[model samples]
Target: MLLPQPRESIQDNQKGKVFFVALFTVCFFIMHYGIFVFVQTSMFFAVSSIYRGDLFNLSIPALK
Candidate 1:
């Protein structure tokens, strides 16, 4: 018969799982939000430049 594992070890394993899940969720949200913001900003700049008749001069604000 297989012996049961200790309770402390089981609890620690569960805690580790929870920590990794929380960390993954936070990282995913940050990456998604960052990508969204980047796309939106780029599109806004592109449109604005086109509207102002300077499409060729379109550049990131930070590069100015």
Candidate 2:
């Protein structure tokens, strides 16, 4: 037979589980946001670089 757990202990256990789940969810969102920002900035930089390259080629006809 299983031993009976105290009500207070069971409540505390449930609270801890909830806290852990909340912490995990917050961390996951933060990590996801960071990755999204990184991708956006990287893409912006890539596009800007390509644009600059085109401008540079256009400005100096001797380079062509």
Candidate 3:
């Protein structure tokens, strides 16, 4: 059976590490931006809904 050389194994390990690091970095940014946008949109919708409700209440006259 053929055996792996020490230098070649080291190089392979380095390549694997680099690939994983790059992948992690990309996924981290994507998740971060996704969460940020989701939160922003949710807040905007919540605020707008509350504002609309207040406007509706204000426009309606109170019954004596």
TM-score of each model, paired residue for residue: 0.60, 0.59, 0.56
Screening candidate 3 with a backbone cut-off below 3 angstroms (N, C-alpha, C), the clashing residue pairs are none
Error of 2 at 1 (Å): 32
- Which candidate ranks first by lDDT, i.e. highest? 1
Off by over 4 Å in 3: 1-10, 50-64
Q: How would you order the candidates by TM-score, starting with the best?
A: 1, 2, 3
lDDT of each: 0.73, 0.70, 0.68
lDDT value, candidate 2, whole model: 0.70
Error of 1 at 63 (Å): 10
Tens digit of lDDT per residue, candidate 3, span 1-64? 5674465556765888867988999999999999999888767856665343443353323432
Report the Cα lDDT for residue 56, model 3. Answer: 31
Q: Superpose all Cα atoms of candidate 3 onto the true structure and report the RMSD in Å to 1 decimal.
A: 10.7
**lDDT by residue for model 1 (1-64), tens:** 5685566667755878867988999999999999999888768876766343344655455555
| Superposed Cα deviation of residue 46, candidate 2 (Å) | 0.1
Lowest summed lDDT window (length 10), candidate 1: 50-59
For model 2, the superposed segments whose C-alpha errors exceed 4 Å read: 1-10, 50-64
Q: Write the per-residue lDDT of candidate 2 for residues 1-64, one digit (tens) a residue.
A: 5786566667755878867988999999999999999888767856765333443353433444
What ranking emerges by lDDT with the best candidate at the front?
A: 1, 2, 3
Best of the candidates, TM-score: 1
